[model samples]
Target chain A: MTGPGRPAAVTGIGLAVSGLGTPDDLLQPDGAEEAFDPATGLTGRAMRHKDRASRFALRAAADALRDAGLLTGATFAGPASRTCVVVSTNFGNLDSVCTFADTIAEDSVLGLSPLGLPHTSSNSVAGWLAIEYGLRGPNLTVCNGGTGGLDALFWARAMIAADRADVALVVGVEPDTAPVARLVGHRPRLDGAAAVVLESVPHRRSRGAPPRAVITACTHGAALPDAVRAVRGTDRQPVGLWLTPAGPRPGDAASSWCATTRDLTARLGECSGALGVLQCVAGVSYLDASGPGAVLATSADGPDHTAVAALLLTAPGQAS
Target chain B: MSCVITGMGAVAAVGGGPEQIFTALCAGTSGLTKLRAFDLNRYRAHHAYEIDDRTGPGRDEPLRATRWLVDAVEQACADGGLTPAARVPVLLGTTLREQRSVELWWRGEGEVSAADLHFGPALRRRFGFTRTYTFANACAATLYALGLATDLLDLGMADAVVVAGTDAITESAFGTLDRVQNRTPEALRPFDRARAGMLMGEGASAVVVRRDGDGDRPALARIRGVSMNCDAYHPTAPDPAGIAAAMHAAHTRAGLGPDEIDLVMLHGSGTELNDAAEATALHAVFGDAAARPLMTAIKSMTGHTLGGSGLLSLIVAVLSLHRGVVPPIAGLTDPADEAAGLRLVSGTAATAPLRTAQVDAFGFGGINAVAVVERS
Candidate 1:
């Protein structure tokens, strides 16, 4: 295990959305449609047929792959060369799972749809990516509520450090689904997917690739004071995003805002897994000369909370 | 880095814990029985090694499989002399999460709310574990859980990690199995020439893991390597060549010639296609050793636990190390016609000093996981 100094570099990024179904369509002001859904409480045109999570994941994964130049045939040394996929979600296709459950309840003897069972699995997206990209390496799907995205990224970094995979595709995708909307007492809002291609710094520098974001540290737990103190001494002005029900407190807005999965879920309706991607988009949107802003994603259980804080620093000239 | 098995606990049809299951296995008594747990009037296949409600901690109300999982984890922690307050990160693997809820809903009883069904928080709450992770990838969930646990311990993420897996066959799951045409009507006979399909079983198993420090259980066996690969080649059927993700995992992790392995625990769904593909994969990985390693399929006895099958097989391998005996294949009357020189343990258990073993767990969506365990 290396120290906090060794950063987990983001070499590539990808995204797909309801308004923007593909990588090129994403972020285009006019091309994207207004994604809505009544069952999920989404108010925009959602992706057709494809589950919200898969669409979001494919979009983010494609963008990250393209950004890293991996799609362009660029290769890096270290774990990046043997890329793995880690996708995390809060509610993995609960709509589909519940649908299957409903079918079984209806007729015990009736045959269930083959397609539905496969889609209902939590790891369906990861399995799809592995098959779509032929990534026969380590593939995992983690479900830890809102903190899933941060956890996925942290796991990708650890996989790289452990020399398990050379390049890691860390994707967080949540889609607006009816069951998810009911569970959180709100519609899915701005359901999105974000992909970050992580690799070792040495490999990128050696390949003369365009510099990407440098992830300084990612720590998770209940104690925010200690994490806050660790990054306070840094030169960059970190912007924190909290996605909790209450939103960020008034004073916490200086560097931290209440940008949580619950907030994203409410806005995006059924998109519960892609909340992290929306947070990443929020983090990327806030990037400026303030250097790469620190994004902290937190979720709580009773008195305990799990916070994943990452220092997002863009390349020297690429700060936009 | 070597991965040690500090503690193990299992709940199965024949018994509630490891000792009971092992005793039944030693006696060559099958756990397969008529499905009295649930009314199977609509379905044809009624045989399953069902878990009695009173067997676990909470008996009054039919507890969710997650409760049994929590009990197993508690047993493992108690066996390892660790506490939940120690903050041991937990990894839970299961194919069906809160599936019993569907049955309850079918009966017009109270529905299992989303909060209770969601795995991550429910597990944390059940065990009072703070840092926890869960995987729901078909049959490969538990093996993948073990693989992730090993990686976490090796990376020093936590000094100790608890890996548990559970899957209780409910009426809803049985209906799905019946729909898929994968459920066997009578018994599970892995590699048997006349084998039809699989017998669904339910249970929970947990293993406590800690770094190999100065004083650890003498390192009973080392989890030398683990690999999880997706076939993505097919949704249900495995790749015909079987030279895909799972083969790579076995070869990559063990870094051993096929001859080095002493035994093989197969995914063995009792279907012709699955067994043939597995045999082919074994041939690719072991080459000559494919014929040499004492291949055994425990599913014939324990039934398929889906997510928990991988870890359950691994526990059996660990028991093989402890007892120095390889359990027999319960129902293999005739080997597959295309079977090569592969040695299938049948009828009686075999005594052998098992140094290295490979356990395989393949799932629906082309997910394949392999783990290599060895005597330290």
Candidate 2:
């Protein structure tokens, strides 16, 4: 819906993490507990079989929709068929799969629950979000390591750019269960979900909805800095802030071109797949409080950092 | 922008490569036999379409599906004559990713990590790819990835892209199916009046897609259009309306009418609801056309290959368009009442002059995807 130079707008943002309730909470470090219940905010039927990661996703999705003024009570008031859902997570369903396999191993085929079968699928989170909200547009799930969150956002932007949908709901979530902890060892794990609502400029304007920030570019490259450079291409417009997975260090190269750099992982436990969306959410909160400025969010795929992705966003009225 | 398929590779229960699998299908060879991947002493279902350990990556491998994935990608690159320096972006799709290895690890027999559950690092290490995406959209994942690959090419993101899917049978999936089926089916028989349920299979498939005239490589087929959507209705039940909408959208985007399609690779999982729902959707889309497309279900021989089934079907569709041969849905005798008006290939392979063909794939959680491929 945006022209070549025009940018898509982020109308709303939502987050659901242990001991944290909002995006602004990330700025102030608070001790997070090991367990957080997501059932308090979830309403409606057929949610009994939803896995932990899916529950976090549903809660975050609901909050995002409400923030966007597209949802009230338990019903969505927007154009359901014109909205799409994309989810990103690497080990969201590992616990469920392991439990199901245990049931089969111990009790044979008879012990398998019919309802439990669907939860083993990695896309169950996206599917449940769609079924709960009746979003019939394109549905996708990404599990491509650390850059997965950025990849999800890129696809959402791509869908809107190609006119496949007018609005896109992008979610990133991960579960820290017994099996996941055993597999990942002592690495920082994500225990909740983060979501962003992206809408075309025309669609946002037609609905008279205010934009928190506008996304100018999203891309994938071989490295995080290169990805940011690719998106910022040939432009001398200085970046106001850089939100990265790793914390900012002294004499950081990003400091030369960006006003400030904030470490997402330092504030919000290493989120892995949720890092990108959380970065965008943090960027939006910063721009909302700091006035017109540009923010660059970047993440890498694995320890090798061979694959990376970046997203560039600016305040509502700032030039891209 | 027009995206064309420059190369394809596949590894199914019946054979190891696209050409060998196609030839075996044409000869009515089925891979269904006693389930040997695991102990079946307490299970009701005794048979499945499984790849032989000797022919596959061996039974002791940590992750059999990853090996298959590597082989398929290597074959695809070789077929396309693409060097490792090309650095093609990869888009991978799967339902159960490395779950078999996880199952082994759970049983205290193998070692598996969080990294083993994904394919990005392995792919990059093997092919030096800098950009790769993994889509876990259930059985329809491959088609969903294919659609995104086309989008990447259309946007000029890369000169070439590799769309792939891989998965192995897991104890969880097999047990779930075994408990859900009313009666354990001895063999998968799609579209038959006596169809019972689906049998699980394992394998991997890949296709290299490039913009038309991107290189000197010969194009195997042109990907006209790909459409994906979610039913948002039920988790396991296939929605006829959603399937029909995807098919209609694919045809509309391809700039072709329903009559233009000469063949259709049906998502025939041999399940009662899936077959009936697919047929209903097909009838709704075609609507009394004089010459509707000839429908074929390779799962009759390959078994339901889960995640990789969609790309496997696309590869077969391309071969059919090139060779003018349509493999029959083996074991199907009498068509069901829901499939009465449709023309289904059965008993033996059919010969036809095909130009345009469509591949259908639907997954758990109501995901649906359809792709139209044609000989340009």
Candidate 3:
């Protein structure tokens, strides 16, 4: 197992749950909410150019960066040289892709939108973020299913620990469309997106950043043996906040810390790939107000099951 | 903690499984054929390395691409002597999802499944796998999967991780190639003077990576090092600096020098930009040296499988290292002016016992992945 690197600081966040608009919205998840708009500040040609998924991603990144005080006036003032960009997306801009393909099919090969083809790639959102912010370190785009969001978090932390980057911007995004909705089985009221900024403890201290949550430890295992051991060292807990696609899939290794495992399926309906990050956001907010929370994300409903567990520890003097 | 390739499987345009594909490569057989999967009458290019299903009545239960994935895994499991549990971790890469719905969904013929968009979860359910990863970095997809497999094995997350990649030629990709970019001419002839472009190929290839102590079977090769990095340059075109950085990182991680690379697997997509970009990156890494490790190109034989291309080349590399031969580049008249500086393997298979082999794949989205394997 790799050494748990210096605690990466989650200093900023941009949440886009369907019913709830922000992390504050997550705290009071009453079935009532306002219309979701990630394209608020981002306008003009860039907005016109990006598809829904990319727009959602850009909005989150911009908001998280703003929350982190990395913005200088209207631009990001953080050290772009070392800030890594990671975007976790499931389908990518499949709507534009389908439409692009439709044009080619209805017309010919030349019947293509040169502007649309690049955005059709699975990594387009990540690439656009990198280009938008000029982040040059490692522009990683992961495409795992429900765990992709947490996997991006795990990877971002590892990079920080390995001295791969000084700062990381990770966004978990999934846009809903007729095609994507049919694939994942449920459509959400709004496309989901969440962004969190992770800075090295050293970088955070240097910036005198006021961090919200400290990721004490984050890991994934093929077997549950290591996780049980890791949990034994944590505060005694119930299923504090369970984050499942529906009522937990059969093979999910429900954490010992969960109190009331929250069912996202019925509340927010089902989201495509943004579920993991949304869960992480909720976990962070829960830890901030409630107590220590564990996110148990499972993806073995088919047969061969794999579970990724992430622990959110309240900062020193957080709460009981 | 050494990572070894105990078993490998493939369903390529040239042949099925590694042994057959290796044999076909040695025979210099071309698999490029007329595009009959559907029909391409109006297009200027009417051929690709597409697999034609002439034997079986079109059965549509599980996806055809997913079937290839499972078959390749079965072959790898058999070779490794592994009865993988119900939850073996799987990592797959491909540019396009199983295209069952590409036409069907568009024309109101069939509905799209989770398999078409998010293939990992669908395959994970189909195979009953616990942990699964899908890397879609165009041509470099499987190499990315291979690198992640090494990480899972190194971290002891799983004793064995399935690293596979597959792509079925569809109107989405073929349409793009036929009209947008890298238009194919007959077949792929990469790094050659008479290069036309790359033909879209359909394939699914897998490698079983196990911790050194997982099995008693002899390892085919050892993964000494692997690196994945993106070119922050353009979306489609590759940045030489980005490609070189990835190659250098792979070398450093492998603890090998440029000279240690006994055999080099070129990304050679048979396109002008891809081939030129690859050559520039290689020149930066290896420089002008006559006695550099002998180089070989495989897409000419296997066709560019997009997401499956890198893994197909990797499967070929493992076979080459294990069998001690580099397959010839078919349909070659002369080397391109830019590639003239690089050593090309042609005419017949070269039998040079190689110690270290470095396989490279540069995908469309500017993702460059490199892996170095040594004869185990």
Best lDDT among the predictions, by candidate number:
2
Better of 1 and 2 by TM-score: 2
What candidate 1 gets wrong by more than 4 Å, as runs, is A1-5, A19-52, A72-81, A186-192, A202-209, A224-272, A288-292, A301-320, B36-44, B54-63, B102-108, B170-173, B182-184, B214-216, B240-252
Q: Residue B237 deviation, candidate 1, in Å?
A: 2.4
Which scores greater on lDDT, model 1 or model 3? 3
DockQ of 2: 0.58
What digit string (tens of lDDT, one per residue) describes model 2 on residues A17-116? 7767667776655654433455465444645778888888987888788888888787887778888899999878888788877887788889888877
Put down candidate 3 lDDT per residue, B1-376, tens digits, no spaces.
Answer: 7898888889887888888989999889878887764446446678788666534433222256766777787788788877666447677887765544544565564566554455665554555565566655567778877876777666555678888878776665566566655444887898888888778777788888888767878888889988877776666777888888888888998999887888888888888887788788888887754248878888888788777777788878888887889998888778888877666788888998888888888875577789999988
**TM-scores of all predicted structures:** 0.85, 0.95, 0.88
**RMSD, every candidate, angstroms:** 4.9, 2.5, 4.0
Tell me the tens digit of each residue's lDDT in model 1 across B15-113. Answer: 777777777775676778877555465666878766766443422133457777877787777776667752577888877666566345434544555
**Rank order (by TM-score, best first):** 2, 3, 1
Distance (Å) between predicted and true CA of B249, model 1?
4.1
- Model 2 residue runs over 4 Å out of place are A1-6, A31-46, A247-251, A318-320, B54-61, B85-87
